[model samples]
Target: MSGKLARLQQQHDSLQQEHKALQQTKNQLNQELQSIQRTASNAIRISNERNDLRKQVADLTRNVADLRQQNRDLSNESNRDWFLIGAAVVIAGILIGLLLPHLRFQRRRNNWGAL
Candidate 1:
């Protein structure tokens, strides 16, 4: 009877030690799970931020393209205006050159006839 009781006592102590070890392992696993959750949250936030930045970059690129197109259009319009102005000046100069000499000759002829 004494031997059986001692054996049972030893078995009980062993079980107690195993239960304590399991509890420690459970606590450690919980801490690790919390850490993993935090890491996952951070990763998600970073991914969202990266996506936002990409979108902003795309919008900016589109804006730059639009601005470039506008600049080209303005430059073309300016060139066309300058060409029209130059053509007008040239036509006016040519008309003046052709008429001035003819008027002067007519005046001279009229004066001679009167004399």
Candidate 2:
């Protein structure tokens, strides 16, 4: 009877040791899972920030393109204005050159009649 009791006690001690080891393993696995959750959260935040920055960059690029087009349009308008002014000045110079000789001949005739 004593031998039977000793064997039962040994079996109970082994079962207890296995249960303790399983509990330790469960605790380690829980800690690892929590660490993974934190890492996933950080990754999600970084991805969202990257997406927002990309949107901002796209908007800025569009704005720059629009401004460049406006600048080109303004430059074309200025060039057209200068061309018109130059053409008008040339026409006025030609009219004055043609008219001045006729006026000088008329003045010479009027002076000879007075003499």
Per-residue lDDT of candidate 2, residues 9-105 (tens digit): 9999999999999999999999999999999999999999999999999999999999999999999999999999999999999999999888855
Q: What is the lDDT of residue 99 in candidate 2?
A: 93
**To one decimal, what is the Cα RMSD in angstroms of model 1 from the true structure?**
4.2
Best by TM-score: 1
Report the alpha-carbon TM-score of model 1 versus the true structure. Answer: 0.82
The count of backbone overlaps in candidate 1 is 0
Query: Could you tell me which 10 consecutive residues in candidate 2 have the lowest summed lDDT?
Result: 104-113
Total clashing pairs for each candidate:
0, 0
User: In candidate 2, how many Å is residue 23 off?
Assistant: 1.9
Query: What lDDT does each candidate get?
Result: 0.96, 0.96
Candidate 2 clashing pairs? none
lDDT of 1 by residue, 1-113 (tens): 99999999999999999999999999999999999999999999999999999999999999999999999999999999999999999999999999998885434455666
TM-score each candidate. 0.82, 0.78
Pull out the clashing pairs in model 1: none
Error of 2 at 112 (Å): 18
